[model samples]
Structure formats: C-alpha cells, structure tokens
Target: MQLQPWIIMATISAFLIQICLTVESPPSADKIDLGVHPLELEHFVNMAHSNQVERSCGKYVIPRVTSRVGFSYSANTSFYAFVNDDMTARDNLKFLQRWFLKFPEYKNRDLFLTGESYAGHYVPQLAQLIVQSKVKFNLKGVAIGNPLLEFNTDFNSRAEYMWSHGLISDITYEAFTVICNYSQVRREIVMGSLSPACSGVISQVSRELGKHIDSYDVTLDVCLPSVVSQSERLNQPRGTEKIDVCVEDETIKYLNRKDVQKALHAHLKGVSRWSICSEVLKYEYRNLEIPTIHVVGAVLKSGIRVLVYSGDQDSVVPLTGTRTLVNGLAKDLGLNTTVPYRNWFQGRQVGGWTQVYGDKLSFATIRGASHEAPFSQPERSLVLFNTFLQGKPLPEATVVL
Candidate 1:
C-alpha cells in the first residue's frame, strides 16, 4: 500500500505507540502488517505485546504512530515532533486533542492509557484530559510501569533502595540522606553544576555501585558498547537469565540498516542516523517536580481502574518507591483492601506480589523483571495484561485443574 500525505500540525516530542486489539484475530484477507523482528523501530517498549497478537483472534488494527504521550497517527512519516524544554503536559494534551479529532474510530473503544519511564508523566496527564474533556473517548483505565509519580517520594526513596538492595554501604546511604536528598542532587545536575558536597557523595555512591552495574536493572549486567561483529553480538549470551542486557546493541544495528528503514516506511527527517531517543527533543525538567499522583486519584474517583506495576529488578525507579506510593494512595482514598497483599502465581511458582484496593485499584511486582517488565518477562507480563483488560485482580493463589 502506497502511503498518503498526512497534514503536519504543531508537532510534539519523543514517543512512539502501536495499537492492537487483545482479542484473538481471525485469518482474514486483510491482515495487519506488524513490523517483523529486524524491521521495527528501536527503543520501543521491549517485547511489545502487540507482536504476540494471534492470527486466529479477530482483532482491530489501530495506527501505532510515534507519540508525544497521547498523539496518534498512521506510520507514514518517520520525521519526529520537535518539542522543547518549555513544552509541558498541557501542550501534550493539546496534541492529543488533534489526534482524537482525526481518528473518530477511537470514540467507542475502551481507552486504557499505559506508559513506561517518562510516560509516567505523559500517560496520566493525557488520561486526565480525556476524563475532563467534552469529547467522549471510552477512557477505561491507566497503567504505568516504574513511573515517576511524586518527585520527593520517588526520587528521595533511592537512598533506602540503594541500601536495601546492598548496592551501597550503610555509611554511603546515610551520607546520601544527611547531605542532600536525591532530588536536590538531580536539580544540581540539571543546572549543569553540582555542589562540592553533592559531587563528593555522588562519586562515592558511583564507586560503590561501579561502572559495570546497570542502575536501570541493578541485578542485570550492563551492555558492552564497543562490540564488533554486530550479528555475533546479537546472538551472544545475555548478561542475566531474565533480562536481555544487550538488546539495545541489536536495536541500534537493526534500525540503521537501509533495508529495514524502507520496509517500515521510515525516513530520517534530517539526521544522518536513526537513534533510540530523539536528538531534537528538549524536555522540561521542572515537570518532574509537578506531582501526577493526585491526577491518578482523580482517574480512580471517576471510576476508572488503575493498575501500577513494578519490575522488582529495576533500581532507577525502584519498586520500593513505587510500592510506597501505591500503598499511601490506597490509604488516602479510604479505599478498602479487597485482597490482602499476597503472592500471585504465573504457573506452579510464584510470579510476584499483588494487592487490590476497593476492587478498582491494583499494585503488583513482576519478579526479576527490569524497568521494562514486559520485555524481561513477556509471558508473566501478558498474564497481568489480560487481567488489567478484564478489570480483574492478579490472582492471589494458583489453582490446579
């Protein structure tokens, strides 16, 4: 199918999204052309569930355009939306307004908002817009993976996480808290200078963690960048049993291939090479200070199901911080604990821990999963995915036939 021209409006920044129905798809004359192994874009939510769509399941195909949080479009232009430091979540909502207007089909469908990392801010803000707006999108639920919800709670908790996981020493952890919190440390970084005290302690922390470690997934091995024979590197043994330490290496090589770009109808807007994150994007760091946890509460009050899941292995947005936020939120809302916290099973063995509050809100941990839980443990993540869509809780215990 030759592509058609898409009108370029005010563009937003770094995000890409693909939409696929969870229902099983039937073998039909017109099949959705899912990007193959070597052809998909890099830095995509790894092990993206859309790839698992079964041919036997009758499904609907929605355009998985490059998103700036909530904007959606067809895969016609590989060119990105250039957004600057001044661009806020409100600006993202404006772009989403254009997206919803363009695609009327999304009106009736259940819109479950989901994001990882930065989208922690984007996804919830967008869902809030849909809920408040006059435009009637079937905004169902929102899920965030290892999100940055509240700056103080999420960032400051790093000290405890670092200490609890044995990543740093008792003395170093004490210094981290006593000298200055992690948020202050990050603010100094954004300002392009660190205080002598901040620098000294940060250096101490780094030395303890070491260059070989991946703060993203503290247990997983860090990727070796100076790899030769790209194909051989792609085929080499992964650093950890559960996570692919070097998936980024393969992604970089694959996306840069000329054949791969053509197959996906992609083009470099002006750059010489395709990169994982947008080079042109200038994100507003202050937005991180703006709390979105209250926005999440608003979503739940409107009767939308909310699920906040964490990959237990991740350290950057550690499960410690996320779990604390979820627990606190449950209490603040006066939401009853429908299911007391307990183990949830994937098969015969335990998958992770889960709890449901007031039956509409859930929090879970994916054991040994990375910042990108679905990529590390696809099967287990899928089980969670199915339950999220069904508005059910993650099982407290496994049952035998």
Candidate 2:
C-alpha cells in the first residue's frame, strides 16, 4: 500500500477530539474574556492572516515578530470529535483510519503526531500503529511536553519537587517519599482499598498542597472556581506572568456556550456539555505503568526523530525525573549527545535548556513555564514548536560583552 500525502494531526483524545486542519497568524489581544485565552477560534483565522504578532518585553523588544506557528494549544486548532470518546485505543485507531480514509488529501503527506499529558501514550502508540498498518502519509516525529511517560518516576518525583519548591515540610516530604506517593494514593483510591498509612500520608499531602494551588504548575496561581466558574466576567491574567489560572474554567464556559458550539459546528451528541477531560470514559490506569520511554526507543530505532521536552516549572512531572529518564533512554539507544546540555535562547534570554542525542533523539526543557508550557509561556513555547517542526535545534545562547 502507498503511504498517504502530507501533514499533521493534533491529538486531544482525552476530550475525544482530533484536530483536522488549523490555520493561524499573528495573535492580537482583542479578547473580551479576561481569564480565557486572548485568542479564540472565532477570531484566530482572521488574526492568523493578519501577518504580524504584536510583541511585548523590554530591551529585546519585538513589535511584529514573524515566525511559523502551530496549534500549540487547542485554542487554535480546527478539530473533529469522535462520536464516542469512551473507547479503547484500538477502537479509536479504527475510527481514525476511517477518518483518514475520508480525507484522501491526507494521503502521501508526512504526518506528525503530537500532544501533551497522557498523549505521551496516545501519540506514540498511534504512531506505532500507523507503522504497523499500511497507512498513507509519512510518520514524521513526535513531541510531547510535561507528559506522563513513567508512572513511578513521574509521580514519585513529586516528593522532591514539593520539598525543593517549599510546598511541603521536610517531615511531610520524608514520609510522602518513604511511605506513599501520588501514584500509590491514586492506586489506593482506584482499588477502593486505601491503606491506613497511605491515607494518612495522602491527607497530609493534600492539607499541605491546599485546594487553592494549581499543583500542575506550582508557580502558577489556582483558578478560583467561585469567581471564574459559571461567570463570563473577564479578569486580569492572575495565573503567572500572563497565564490566567482560571482559564480552565473560562474554556469550559466558552465551549458550553450554544453560540460557540454552533460556530465551530460542534455539539454534545452524547454528553451534557463539552469537557476538556472525559468523565464517562473508564481509563485503564494500568496503562500508566507501562513506560512509553521504551516505545520512544522503538520509534527511534525505526529512524523517526523524537523530541521529548519538559516544562521545568511543572511539579507534576518534574524536570529532574524527566531528565534522568531521557538521559537513560539516550544511553540505552546508544545515541550520543550531539549538542551538549546548555541554555538555549529566545532573543537574548535563556528560553530553556536543551540537549540533542545522535540527531535522532533530543530532550529539552522550557524554562519558567508551566505543565502546559504554551498556556503559560506562549512566545517561548512557539519558538520551541517552530524549531521542533523545522528539525532545527533551539537557538544557542549569545554572549554579551
């Protein structure tokens, strides 16, 4: 069978949506919704065609920065939702095959698979499946951020992250690491058989974390559900530098709006509302234990490029653990570091730290960004996105006299 022609697909399987085709341009902030992202689907097409991204910052001032953009966040993608999201990967793949069949134009184009969070699994697995089957389109590469690659490493790293970041007491950290962890607590919750010891440690951790914190990106503020939820009021970007912590709530409100759905040609066929996460779908939690880092190796062995990046500020999937795993993967694959680990620049500032291995595999970190890197640091994230797609290394830091 001949491979299909060109391009990419952005996965949001958690929400049962597959981005079809998306167009973007210079982002202008004329949004009325405060907590919501300034750019929305309603205006993105026009904005993208505008040809100039208004920039803000000191010294490294750029008024109309021109660079390639992607659907770095779902905020800018055109997507098609699976009729039923509560399905297995096999089922989803079959649906996607049919979806691909419908778009004959997609045949023969190089297809790039990408996503965040659990997509570390979804993206790689789907790419592997595409390889196994005779699919149209070339498998380009994969990029995932702050993803859950290994459950033990990813979840267990929280103790150190919490302690180092001053989110938990030393006593709490010791017990949390020595006694229980986010994964263990979760397993207990899932099995409906919480150990007394696990319960106590979990309760302590929860108390320490508090409900007001967005544990995903500890540096970012939490969305006040009372204020952002069920209200259309706009507020200042209170999350981080420009990230509105409550944007999560804002997205929900926007998607559920009847006018918004109508505009997107979307509807809640089997659900009451559009949700970023699926509530009805029963995920096999065991899948988390099966590390995709190995699957990443398999992809590399197949000669496909792999880029595993992290948002350094994410406590949920701390950079420390991801660094260890990525390094180990490089060693296992016998891939030598092509570019030594060092700071990369966006303009004159260190955007993040990156390391490339054997040209085929690379790892990098987005400095001062959140778990959702783009949401927290859009310009920096866009830089990374552009570089990754171009198969170019992040810009090297420049020396100033």
Candidate 3:
C-alpha cells in the first residue's frame, strides 16, 4: 500500500509537536436523547473532508484519515477505525465521552472498543477510559481481539512462540533478539530494519506456501483462514514445511505497516531520541498507572463487561499475554471466580477459552484467526459482538481459561 508522502515525512520528523491551548471548562453532564441509532452516523456519512476514506455499515459510517494536514489520527493506508497515537488515551477517552454526551443515542447503547496487534495497546487504553465514563454515562462492554495490552510479558512470549513454531525465519528471529536485547541497538534497528524484515518475510512465506499465488501482502488479516486451511491440506513434498510461514509474514507485516510506523513516529516525535526504546517510551502522557487493571476491573464490576481475546496463531501478542493481563484483572476484582464463561463462536473448535469474574469482567479467544479477528474472521467477529451487545455470557464453545 502506498502511504502519502506527507505522512512519510511526518514520520521522519517524529518529534515535532502540535500545540493546543487548554481552557478550563465545566464538564457537561447533560444526557442526550436516545435515538434509534447510538452514533452520529450523519456527521461522518457525508463527510465533506476529501482526505478521509469513508464507508457505510448499517447505521454506522466509518471514516479513515488518509492524510495528515494539521492533527490526524487513524491508520493512513486502508480505512479502519484507528485511534490517534499523537494524543494520550485519556484524551481520546475524553473525546469519546464528550461525543456520547453530545449524541443521545450513544448514551444507552452497548459501547465497545476493539483493535488488533499494536491496537492491542489501543484496546486496553480505550477500555480504561470507558470505565471512567461508566461513572457518568451508560456503557456496555469492551472487546479486544489479539490485543497488545501487556508489553514485556505478552509481547516477548509472542515473539518466542512464533520463533519456536517456525513462523519467523532464524535470521529474523536473531535480528529481533538483538534489537530487543539492547535498547539503543533495538531503536536503531526498528527505525531502519523494519521494512526489510517485513518485506522479506512476506516474499518468502508467500512463495513457500503457494505457487499459484501472485502477490503476497501479509498485512491483510483477511487472507489467513483460506491460506492456512489450504496449506494444511497441501500433500506436497513439504506439506507442513510452510504451514506456519504466514506467521512470519504477519510479524513482518505488523512491523512494517506504514500506519503503525506512523504511530511509532507519533510516539517519538518531539521527544529525546537518544534510545531506541524512545519510540515507545517517548509517549510519556500515554503511560498507565500500575493500578489501571484494578481500576478498570472495579468499574466493570458495576454491571459492565470486559472481554479480552487473542487469536490462537498470533505471534505478536499471543494467548498467554492476554491470559496474564486478565489474570491481573481477576486478582484485582477479588473474586475467586464468580463469573460464568462459555463458547462464543460456532464452526471453529473451541476458540481458545474464557473466564468470568462475576458479571462484569470476561475473556474469550477467537479460533482460526490472527491478530485481527474482524479482518480474518468477520462472521465470528460478528458473533462476538452479538453476544456482547446483548450482554450475554460468551457461549460454551468459548473455553474457560
């Protein structure tokens, strides 16, 4: 995918800040009329702004900011609902809270937050905000698919698992290990080596998987099930030889996507760039308090739901990391295990598992998918939403972790 030059340039100038003047204003506690629809679809439906890519779904109109002029958010390539990285999650939350307050339909609807891979970070951040909103607004539940909520534990395990499973090449694995081992070297490598590593993985995996395929864009999670199923059935000489190649392809794809790179740039822009970890570390305002999980869990206890899921084959943020994050929340809630967990999707073998801590907090996994379940398995994704929207426990097919 071709990213706009301005975005590319903005990425290079990662530390440049856009200034905003803050004025103290009383928080509006006004409630809006609950319309049939929960969102202001019309505001986005006929967006006069030319740079945005808009798509209509039911009463919803999703817009993508394709180019950055002044201040911008959303991934720049394809149109998906991407939160802005330039601002703190708190800021993003405040924006959404005010939005719901302004639009009455959203007040009583089942509000949700979702994302994949790096969005893993976004998913929890938004969830934290929603919990805060519940004190004042009507909120439902939050669902995170293959999210990257925990960095050290979840992220490291994902990389190692992908390596052991042969999804990433030995060389790439070594490169990752080196980059992750030293802070300075890792930053230099991430900034410079991301594209090469990503492109190489895509090429190698596509070729090894199918000769019939022409283009290999591993970034699209939409391509997985068919590719994985077919490759599993290929009775050729090396039947399982490339079975997991897509994993490596996905890893590289995640690292190289211009939008994510843009996020990293946004995170680093205008900060001290002395360390490689600076890209992520520079986003000081985005940091969460250690008690965040507990605070979020407490809010959920008040009748809201929290569902965190991971794709079985995801190497970026594996099932274990999600499990760890949930465990933390569970501990905070102080329930030995009072909530019920069950199957949430059909057709796929018990998509991982789920566990509920009372009615407020829940967790589940999507089977036969990667980081992005909506992109990889829309039908199942819809099933998840259907259950959550109705405020029902995930089905029996979803295992209890």
Candidate 4:
C-alpha cells in the first residue's frame, strides 16, 4: 500500500479545515473566518516552508490538516449517531487505507500522525491499528499536544493546576482534592448523575473561577460575545499575546455558511447548523476512562517514535500530570533517559523544556501556552513539530553575550 506523503494533523473537537494543499502566504489578520483559524494554520505552514526548516530537515513536506468525514461538518448523524474512540480509530484506519490506495504516487514517503486534546486517544488508537494491521505505511512518528493519556491522572491534576495558578479559592481546592476530585465529578457527569456534595463543590469552584476565565488556558481571557451569543464578534484582546480568543466562534460561522459548505461538499444532515462539537452524535463518554498511555507504549515498542507534549499554562491536562505519566511510562518500559530534561529555544527566548527516553519516547512542554498550544504559540509549536519529524532533539537553549 502507498500512503500520501502527508503530515496528518487532527484537531479532536474543533471545526475541520478541509485539506490545504498549497503553501501560499497567509491571509491578513482581518480575515479571520477560514473555518479553522487561518492565522494559526497558515503560520505553521509558512514556518514549515521556511528556509530554516529546509536547512534543518533537508526539505519541506507540505502538511495536510484534515479530519474524519463523519466528524465536524461532514457528520451525518441521522444514520450513524453513536460514536466512540474505538469506532473513530477504526474509521481512521479505513480512511487511511483508502487514501493510500487512491494516492499511489506518494509511495515510500514519510508519514507522521499528529493531533491535540482528545486526539490523545484517537491518534494512538489509530496508530496501534496501523502498526498491527497488514498495511505498510512509512509511519515516522506520533505527536499529541495537551493530550489526555490517563483519565484519573489527567483530570485529577486540574485541581492542583487551578490552585497553583490561583484560579480557585483555597477552600474550593481542598474540596476538589477531598470531597470530590475532577475525575469523580467527570464520572458522575458521564453517568448522568451528580451527587449533592460534588454538585455543591462544582458550584463553589465555578463561582470562584468566575465567568471570564478560560479553563483550557487559565492565563487567557474568554471571549465575551462568544459567551453571550455563542458567536465570535468581540474585538477584545486575550491574555495570551497575539492569539484570537474568538477563533472558535469564527469557525462555527464560517463552516455554517452555505457557500463554504457547498465548496467543501459538506452538508448539515438532520441539523440546522455546523458546530465545533457534534450536537446530534452521542459519543460514548465512558471511553474517556480507557487510558491510551499504554497504547502509546505499544506504539513505541513497534519502533514508531512518540512525542507527548503539553502546554504549561493548560489546567486541563496540565504539564505536571503529563510529565509524571511520561516518566512513569518510561520507567515501566525500561527505557533510559537519552536526553536530560532541559530548556529548548525558539530563537532567543526559551520555548519549553524537553526530555527524551531511549530515543523513541519523549516528553516536552510549551511554555506560556494553552491546551491548544499550536493555536496559542504557533511558532514554538512549529519548531517542536519540525524537530519531531526530523527525529532530532529540540534545540538547546542558545547563549547570548
């Protein structure tokens, strides 16, 4: 089987941007509605095509950021409404097999699997299937950003992260740790019942955190109009420098446009609007508990490199828990530390800290970034992406005299 010479980037819970094949200059900032936040996507692509990237990796590969047909705007919930991680993984495997058969010209070219957030599960599960299947893909590596690897560790860490960041009161933090951790709360919610104690704790925490903050990025401000109308119309600045907090709303509007939908061959099946998340598809919430960290271990054992990265500022799937999980996974796999934990540089500033285990498994954090690190810190994320694809360690901190 011949796979496309493509770097597949998936966003788990965001509006899909149909495949962008060219490397043209990015559009102006004023034009924010390109379905998937053009600034971030274009910025990453432009960086990938830079002369520096060419010098580092010998050549630049045009990346193709796509989502599954049954997801986002392409979903036909009228027929098949229920979906889960396993189903998503199987669907992705089938998609890739068909893609390989259709694009035989991309034979022997390198392919890297990358995603963020819940893709923590989707990417690994699909990779595991690919590795175990009969198909032969030149699978280079897998990278997940602010991924959910383990349920308890990832969700339970939110309390500490919020407390440390001063997003919640001390009393609420204590309640979160003792009376009800996030994992327990999540379980109850999934089961469609929340205990009185957990419900009270949640209310108190919500009151303390207020309505202005974004839990995904504790440091970033929420879009006011988005909160009110559920649309992206505000011109306010966010806590993060240069990131548009209203991009999600813009994407929702763009994807729902009749022209945009027609152009992409997408239609709203048994639905009136296109949402960032599926409104009709009932996802199996229990699947969130099935940890994918072990699947990551299996991928590593299959000779496929794994890169687990986090955005340090993210309370949801914060760097602390991810680091612990990666360290534990390394110890369990008996992989020795090949690269000691150290700061990496993006130009003159520190990009983040990274550590490699036995050359196959690695962990890193994007400093001053959010759960969606690439959306918030595109340049640094690009640097990390390039380094990972080239099978090179992140650049060491540069010295200045």
Candidate 5:
C-alpha cells in the first residue's frame, strides 16, 4: 500500500498522536482519507510549541494524515451526506490499516490516539476496533480531553457546573436541572423542536450566562471583534495568557485565503468558506445516546493505557460528571485507587487533581483550562501529555527546598 500522492504526511519524530476528527463519511465510500488542513496544522504547531515537545523530547512528529475520517476539502458534498459513529469507526479502521502499510516506520514506534470533545466516542470506538481486529500496531494508549463518554452524564452535568461556577443564578440552575436539563435541551434540539418550557429555560440560561462568556471556558473572555479586533489584539498581551479567543476567526481568515489553500494543497469543494466544523455532513444525532464508557472499559480490559483528562473550567463537559463516570467504571472493574485523588504539579504551581484506577485507567483535570485544554493552559496540558506518553503518573506535588 504505497502512500497516495494526495496523502500529506508530516513526520515529527518518535511520538505520533493522530487527531481524530469525528465527522461522518459519505455513504458510497468505505474509507475516507482525511487530510490535514491549515487550521489543524496551525493547531498542532501551536500544541507542539506550547508543549515544547521538540525542545525537550529531541524530535517530535505529528503525522498530518489521520485515519479518523473527516470532510476533505476536495471531497464531494453529496458523498458524505450521512455519518454515524459505527460507520466512522469502520472507516477509521480501514484508514489505519492502509496507513500502517504505507508508513512502516511508524509501525514500531508508539502510536496514541488522541482527540477532544466528541473524540471520546471516535477514539474509543477506533481503539476497540484495533484491538478486536488484532492489528499489530504499537498502540500504547489513548487520551481524550473533555470527551463526551456518556451523553446523559456529560450533558446533565452542565447545569450544576454552570451554577457552581457562578455562571448561572440559583433560580436558573434549579430550573435548568428540573425544568429542562441540558440533555433534554440537546434532545429537543436534535429532534428539531424545543418545547416551550425548555425553550424558556434555555433562553433564561443563555441570557443569564450572557454572550460575552465562553461556555467552553467560563473563565475565558469571549472574542469581541468590535471591542478587540484580531489585528490589534494579536499584538497586545492576552489577558488569558497565550490563548487567543479570536484564533478561530483568524484561522477561518487564514485558511480561506487563496494563497494559503494553495500552499496546503486544499480547496473548498462545495462550501464557500472553510469552517471549523463540517456544514454539509448530516451526522446522526441519535448516536450521541450511545455510551462509549463501556467501550473504554473494553479497551482498558485489553491492557491498553487510558487517560481521560478534563479542563476544570470547561462547562460543556464538566469535570464532575467525567470524574464520577471514571470512578464508577473503576469501581465496576474493582480496580483499587493506586493513586488517591490529589493535586498534581506543573513546576511550582498546582496543575490539577488526578486519581488512578488499577494503574491502567486514569483521570485528571487541567486547572484553569478550557474544553480544549492545551489552547488555554498549554504548559499544564503539556505536562499532562508528556507524563502520559511516558507511561508515568502525573507529576506529584513539588517540594520546596
């Protein structure tokens, strides 16, 4: 299986973490070759710089070509008219099988599947497939940040997270949980109809939270083009450290440029502009109801290391629910807590809390981080990533001399 001419591969070094995009595939295609666009390229570059992987790890490689299916710039819109988890997983398996055959160098190196948010589903499903298929890839582990493991647990936790973080009032919180929880709201939205009561509750919650607050990272400020234009703000120091709230806007602008697209060998097939997410893929909303925690457990049983980390500030997938689910999974497996719940360290500062179950399964949180932890708390997120890759526990408390 020779590498396709269209397949763009960027070799970093020993480490290979493929970012899994959760978009569905076209009905006609058994396997969709997901390309590395400029936006993702920028993301990984920032991640590498932030993590200082090259500075510390000598040589680090990020293979631009990921098996996880996504809408390619040149892909026909009508081909990927529908997508779901099961289909996406099958497509990913095929891609990985082909990828390994093409790049035999990565066959012996450590391969970790990593992604955030919906990747909770994609990563686990793909890993399970790999295990079941008995593929001989050196798959050491998997890590997902702010992942959606269980729909109800993940979604329902949002209300309490909002209230606890002071993003919503007590009254609003009560209504949000009782009247119309996030799960219900999501269900309604997926069904293409919102009940009046749910609608009112959602409206109140939204109004109370306000548009200025980013739900992804409640602590971070929202991007306001008028108040802080991208050009001006880029030169100024970010109040939230290195994170640019307007990076999405900047990425959209950069990727949409004719010169940039030509350089990356990417072009819009049917869409006018390159958006963060796919606009044409009609994904199966019902797939969200399918819990991947059990799939995660299956992977764990196969002796593969699993690290589920959450950014504490992420309201979208609250740490509380994730922690609870991990704890329950550990209990069900009867894995004693090898490491008790304690704060891990990054230099002198407290990074976040972590707990390990049976040494194989672990869960940790990145303090002051968003849904995309690395984008905000880069240094801390880097520490987590580095430690996980080393198969070591997160850094313990730093002792002052």
Candidate 6:
C-alpha cells in the first residue's frame, strides 16, 4: 500500500524530530533570527531556569558568511550582563568549534573578534586563547572599542577622562592626590564625600594637565558622579521604550542564584578582581602575559555587540583610544601600512581611517563620535564592520557628516 504525500511528510518530519531530540540540543533554550541586514543573525539565550532569556555568546550559532568573522564576549562575570570570564571564553571557543563542525563551508573564514569597555580586557584575552588554539582553530583579526588592556593606562585614562569631562573638580583632584598618597582605606573614606563641585574642579585640572593620568583609583570617583546623574535620569519613566540596554532584572536573579554564582566564582578566582587595576598594580601585575585581542569600532559596542562600553567625554581612550588601540593591533599584526584616513561622517573631519597590516590585519576609526560612538551612532558602526568583513580598507568620509 502506497502512503499519501501528506502522511509520508508527517512520518519523515516526526522521525527527524525524534532524531534531533536524541542528538542533544545546542545547550540553548532556542535560536532566534534577529533579521538584521547583510547577515541573517541567529541569537541564543541561556534559559536554564527562569523563563527570561540570558544572552550567551557561546550558545548562539550563525552560518559563517565569509572567511572574515566577528566574535563578541560579555564584559565582566561580576555582572551577568557582561559575563567576561575564563569559562565564557572557553565556551566561546567551544561554540566556535561546534559552529565550524556544524558548518564546514566556513572552514577558511578569517575570524575577527570584537568588543568594548570591559571587553577591552575580554576581547584580547579571548583572542590570545583562540590564537593559542590556532593549531586546531583558524582566526584572522580582532577589534576592541574603549578596551581596558593595560592596567596602568586603563586606570590612568579613566582618571584623565573624568577630570577632563568636568566630572571631577579641584577638590576631587586634591582628594585623588591624597588618596593615591595615603592608604586605600583612607582614600575610600575621603572619596565618599567628594561633591559634584569637587568633581568639576578635578575635570578642569585634568584638562590643564593635557595628558592621561593613572596614579589613582578613580574608577569609582569617575563613575559615581555619572551613575548618580544616570540614576536620577532613569527615575523618570521613558514611556514604553526601554532606555538602558542591560539585563538588570535578569542579572539580579542570576546573581542571587548561589549555584550560578559559584560556577562563575570558581572560574573568576584569580583572573578577575573587584578592582583588577589596583590589585594587580600592587602585587600581581607582572604575572599577566595572556595573549589578548582588543576589538573596537568607530563607536560603542555595548551589550548589543557582546560587551560593555564605558565612554569618557575627556579621554585618551576617547575616540583617540579606540583609534590608537586598533591601529596598534594592526601594526602589531603587521597590518599597519600607509592607508589613507577617510572621513565617513558628514561635517566630520575624520570619521574613519584605514591601514592594512601584513595580509590579514586592518584598522580604522569612526567619525565625529566620543568613546561610545558605536552606541550613539550605529549606522557608521555597521559600515565599519561591513568593511572589515569584506577585508577591505574603511572608506574615507564621503558625504562629510
């Protein structure tokens, strides 16, 4: 007896479903198609417990578009939104391996890892790890935006930025001097009372200094002022749209889960510290030799790009920092050749610049934007990524915006 087409299709579908069920899913709740242009993006979330989705890079799968590739890592494990830890890095590599196995067509794809802020550290560390695994893996380039690569430079840049941005005042600067001179205990106590007026004075002094400063623990001081203002701003409801891009509610839940934190805590033992800059600077600074890659765009690549983006209005790692980091990476990779600087934004002097390193390295910057330009201006970011994907130099500013 011959079966009907519908019946045959149903039987085949059921059999396939059973086979898939037996094969073990990709350790993800479900894969979602973001429907972005140029690339048909697929996303995955770790919903092991709660119904809410927790974005996990290692869990997401997308067909390799070209030999060129892009990777994103969560910024910091301390915060669920930015799960930047050794475990996450291992998982990312594992996922890439799985992705390669699942799609052999991308065997020759050149990989470019990118991220921002906390990713400054995450991107480079992962790149180093992936390169080490190059005997078994293939990678090409990396980009980091406002990365925190060098402990000294990173902290100093933050201090200089805060001062220049008018976020710190002379009083705050004095407090900073005192803190750096005294014990951490005394510094913390003094910093607790510095007001906005003090912060503004610090900013003016920082500008006058005209160079980056790093001799103090200014992360809290720099960010406290902004955080306070942001909290106030967030107090007002923004209609129905979400204003901030973070997994705050889900993050809290994950943090509260002892098992989850334990899993993360184990991996974060030595690599991550509450204030890595301060701790390392005091003791373990010399132990760091991890192969690192920093991915930066012309603008910010916050959670949207798999990292946290910290911007300083007054910064060396400002637009300059991103440009310098990418350029340095390009040069280090032998990709830095005499490529022309192109203006990509309208009325912007230098929206972007390009240099081709050896054969597989490249670098460029975004136009008219500050540290977090990627978040502020995404279109340009897309343009930069697209160019990098094509293995071509970034275009010079044409329309002059």
The alpha-carbon RMSD values of the candidates against the true structure, listed in the order shown, are 8.5, 9.9, 14.5, 7.4, 5.1, 14.0
Best lDDT among the predictions, by candidate number:
5
Taking the tens digit of each residue's C-alpha lDDT, what string does model 3 give over 1-401? 11111111111222321111111100110001111112211111110211111111122211111112111232432322232443434554555555556555545543444334444444455555656555465445555565555445664564455567665677666655554422223233445554554455445544443443312112333324476654553434533342232443343334344574565453222322212121221232223112244444654665656677766656556777677778777886676676545555454455445677766676777666555454344455555555665577655543544
Q: Better model by TM-score, 2 or 3?
A: 2
Candidate 6, residue 394: how far the Cα is off, in Å: 2.2
lDDT of 5 by residue, 1-401 (tens): 11112332334543543322222122222111121111232331231122263332322222222221222522344445666788667766776677668677666766677767777887899899989988887777888888899989999999999998888999999999999999999999989999999999999999999888988899888887874565466556535335667766655666567775676565455667665556555677788888999999999999899999999999999999999999999998999999999999999889999999997899999999988786777678778877887789888867875
Which clashing pairs does model 1 show?
Answer: 15-67, 24-57, 24-58, 25-56, 25-57, 25-58, 26-57, 26-58
Taking all chains together, each candidate's TM-score versus the true structure is 0.78, 0.76, 0.51, 0.81, 0.85, 0.46
> In candidate 6, what are the lDDT values of residues 238-332, reduced to their tens digit?
44422223222333334335574464332223233121021211211122222244432311221112222223232544544444555665555
Mark the regions of model 4 whose C-alpha exceeds 4 Å error after superposition: 1-79, 226-241
Q: Which parts of model 3 have CA positions greater than 4 angstroms off?
A: 1-86, 97-102, 130-135, 168-295, 301-303, 338-349, 397-401
| Candidate that would win on TM-score | 5
lDDT preference between candidates 4 and 5, better one: 5
Lowest summed-lDDT stretch of 10 residues in model 1? 22-31
Task: Count clashing residue pairs in model 2.
Answer: 16
188-286 per-residue lDDT for model 1 (tens digits) = 987889999999889999999989887767777677766464445556575424444566655666656777666555545445665555444334466
**Order of models, best TM-score first:** 5, 4, 1, 2, 3, 6
Model 1, C-alpha of 283: deviation from truth (Å): 1.4
What's model 1's overall lDDT? 0.62
- Candidate 5: minimum summed lDDT over ten consecutive residues — where? 29-38
Clashing pairs in 4: none
lDDT tens readout by residue for model 2, 276-312: 5544333445566778888878888887888888888
Q: Give candidate 3's error at residue 389 in angstroms.
A: 1.8
Candidate 5 is scored at a TM of 0.85
